[model samples]
Target chain A: MTTTEKIRGLILKVAKGKLSQEALKPEARLSEELGLDSLAQSELLVLAEDSFGIKFTHDEVWTVATIGQMVEVIDSRLAAK
Target chain B: MRQSAGILGTGACLPEQVLTNLELAERFGVTPDWIFERTGIVQRHIAAPEQACSDLAIAAARQAMENAATAPEEIGMVIVATITGDYTTPATAAIVQGVLGIPAVACFDLSAACSGFVYGMIVGSHAISCGFCNKVLVVGSEVLSRFTNQTDRDSAILFGDGAGAVVLGGVPEGYGLLATDAGTCGTEYQAIIIPAGGSRLPPSAETIAAHLHYSHMDGNQVFMFAMRVLGNSTLRTIEKAGLSLDDISLIIPHQANRRIIEAAAGRMELPLSKIVINLEQIGNTSSASIPIALHGVLTDGRIRHGDRLVLTGFGGGVSWGSALIRWHSPGSDQIHKKEKNDDNN
Candidate 1:
């Protein structure tokens, strides 16, 4: 699967079926639009790290505000591998 | 294996006042469901204005000693684990030692935040193994309410005041503390902190006005750190004890957040019933959480002789700790003999 698809899948897992696929636009804010609170956002980041076999530095973890931003972070880590 | 230090008795003291979710939700202009959904807390016990951390600690220590059937003269050390000590200079443990008339061989305070009790267990247990003390009293007491920003809804609902204590003494080699683990990620110390009242930011009028003394936590950071550490730390200690998860009867974790505990338990593939959670009525009592929960389960008869338990916690120093203990309550030998005789009949 594409990195975006994979990241979306992890987000849904964090969401626990609360956010539908269509609502997961690239620009969708993890906290605001997707309704993932700070705790859930952290969970999503960790899940993404595990799912993609990648790690986000402390700085990178806080920088991702939206689904598209998270995808970019994951892609860069995957590329570095 | 040689004899090991184990808890002889456990006791806890929560203040009489209750802070229900409804009261806090109304004060914060939110619905009770909003608070409950986020924290899984129905109510928490709050200390009266007259009560201090040391008071709670003394009460709990007294009960622990009494339950252990130990005289004050027998306790060689007093260790109170708390961040909210009554005074800044003297240790709360010293106060507890004095009040309990423990004739202190040694008295000190340990501050590892919520992991304090587990750290105390490790320290107190080692003191016994190395012949430093005969019996050690480890008490975790906190008045987080004093350090909490009542107007700050996020933190206000998450903390409560309470104390719990355990008397530690040698038990049969295979029936006490098996193994323990503790570590700190100092880089994340900022995640949970009281920004002021320390030498770094001494309390000034400006600091007081800014509420810098109140505890502030990065909820996201703590949640992430706890989820990553809690279950894994327990498993690591279990491994160190030369045991597997199957041998653990219950996992007593720090009562920080219900969601964090649930998620960590999920990662370990451990059922919730195998975990002790007393947060609904206690909220997060910081260092006092694990011991308080331990006392709760023990009082409810949930723990029995020979039941192995893994006590784990993560907290402010960005620290985490776990201790593997085989429950060997006082008078367990008699209980065992009675059970055996009944079985024969």
Candidate 2:
């Protein structure tokens, strides 16, 4: 699968039971649109790191708010690797 | 080979006053749902102004000894695990022993933050195994409310005041403690800490003015540490016991956060149904959490004879621990039948 699809998969995993797939558009805000609270967002970050073999700095974690932003960060990290 | 030690009985004492999420949210200018969504805590028990850590410890210890059918004179050692002692000098265990009239035996305090109880279990069990004591009382009591910075939402919403105790004594062979795993990441001790009041940063007029006595934590750091350690430490202890996750009937984890527990359970490929989580009603009681949860399940009849359990915790030391136990009911003839068969063979 593509990097976007892979990251979306991780979000779905974190959002399981609470979110629907239709709500996960590229522009979806993790907290507002997708209902990812602080704890859930942290879980998603850890899951994405393990799944994509990438680490996010503290500043990056706070800045990435949308699903599209998370995808971008993961793709860039993968490129750097 | 050393003698096996097991918990004879358990008890817990939560303060009478309750702090609901709504009340706390008002202080931080956030909604109650906001706190619950982030921490999964509905309310926490707060100690009264006149109450101290020793008061709760004494009450819980009395109930534990009563449940164990043990007289005060029967207990040979008392270990109070806490970072919130009544005084910085005198150990809270000493006060508990005196109040309960538990004889002038070995009494001391243990400070591993949230991992205190499991560490106490290891020490108490070893004492029995070495035949140094016939009975040991282990208590985890904390008055975090006293140290909580009400202005800081992060630490204020997550902590509560309470105590839990267990009576430890010899158990039949092949029963009680099976294996244990404990370790510390000293380099990451700052993940959760109180910056002052200790000798390293002794209390002073400057420290008091700066609000240094209150608990401080890096939420993300502790979250990451807990997620990585809780499941791995439990797995290691289970393996050390010559068993697997399937063999454990229940898992009592430190009640830090629901999301942490869920993530740990996910890592183990275990169902949430098998874990005991009580933080929603009591919030995080630190070292008191495990025994409080353990006591709840036992009282509710969720634990049964011969059932294997895993008790695990992670905390401020960046420390982590897990203990594997095969239950053998105290004051009863119900020994593990499978082990009896092995003994016969």
Candidate 3:
């Protein structure tokens, strides 16, 4: 799957029943727009790591703010590999 | 004239099945010793599949009444503190009252999590002091084992099932409850809670699939919150009672974990010996921990008449409370004579 598609899929999965495809826009803030709090955001990161087989550092968690930003980071990591 | 409602009697009941740390560790993919070192929980009781929270509450309530030599008819109210109830409609306290045949007493459940018993004590004491009730039965009961996820090490090892109760009756001057403080911070409710199974997210097959029925917690945040609140509540209660820390002969804290208790005690400059620690045997019985510890201490003869005691607790809803009580018992001779005289009648 493309990086954008992967990130989008992971967000939906972690949202549980709270968010849906219609609600998630590329630029939407996860906490404010999507209603994922700090704990939920951390859980999403864990789920993404497990699904994509990539490990994230503390810095990366902060650096990747939006879905699009997350996709770019994952794409760069995939290119480096 | 202010009437004082002293703790007339106390009792606790643990389920027959015990789950040890070693057994739980194997299931959760963690080291038994690590669990012990972190929480100091060695074993915990698990209710039988057939038993519910009310069953345990009833048993403990019966024991408390028996010890107090008080009949059900004399109880003016019943307050059960628990998060896990048999159902969402009828309060568990009502069910317990029905089972015990104390229909006249007003009954309801309170949801302050681990601090519940102390909260209940405060409420019951207030009712008696205001002459609203002459006798009150306050209980903290939970069947947390039924709601805990066996595979989740963070929570599974930290909870167990049990119930504890205390009977409160009017005392003479210079005795009974002295002061109480209770507070809640709903803004941090997400720190520890069951994610679903409420009006916000009604239970469904989807919720079930997501494991929303089980307890979820952020251990690190809860740990920080507990330490701060435990110390704050204790200090507030002591001050409110117009006494210093030195006046407190015992500190009955909720048995969430040993580290939390130790950290709070360190902050207050209190010795560990004065604090009651029973989490090793029963884990975190939530609301039941305080009364269970109270019963344990009383049964062991560690607490005596005229001793000053401070009870405190903190838990989910980020709720916390503390109460200062002076121990005073109606003379055993009077109790014996009353029983003998009653038998003759």
Which lDDT tens digits does candidate 3 get at residues B1-345? Answer: 989888988879999999998898888787888788678899999999999999999999998888788888989999999999888979999999998889567899988998889889989988999989899999999999977987788888889999999999898777888888899989889988898899999999998898888999877567657766887888888898889988889999999988778766654567888899998989999999999898888766677678889889899998999888898864332234445666798
Q: lDDT per residue, candidate 2, B227-326, as tens digits?
A: 8788889989999999988899999999998889998678567779899999899999999999999888877767888899999989998899889989
Q: TM-score of model 2's chain A, to 2 decimals?
A: 0.93
CAPRI-wise, candidate 2 is acceptable
lDDT of 1 by residue, B55-76 (tens): 9999998888878888999998
Flag the better candidate by TM-score, 1 or 2. Answer: 1
Q: Measured against the native two-chain assembly using Cα atoms, what DockQ does each of the candidate structures obtain, in the order listed?
A: 0.62, 0.45, 0.02
Record all residue pairs in model 1 with backbone atoms less than 3 Å apart, i.e. clashing. none
Write model 2 residue lDDT over A16-80, tens digit each, in one string: 77776788899999999898877778888877877887778878978999989999988888888
Residue B167 lDDT (model 2): 93
- Global fold similarity of model 2 (TM-score): 0.90
Give the distance in Å from residue A77's predicted Cα in candidate 2 to where it truly belongs.
Answer: 6.1
Give the range where candidate 2 chain B is weakest over 10 consecutive residues by summed lDDT.
B332-341
Report how far residue A25 has shifted in candidate 3, in Å: 44
Model 1 chain A — which ten-residue stretch has the worst lDDT?
A: A46-55
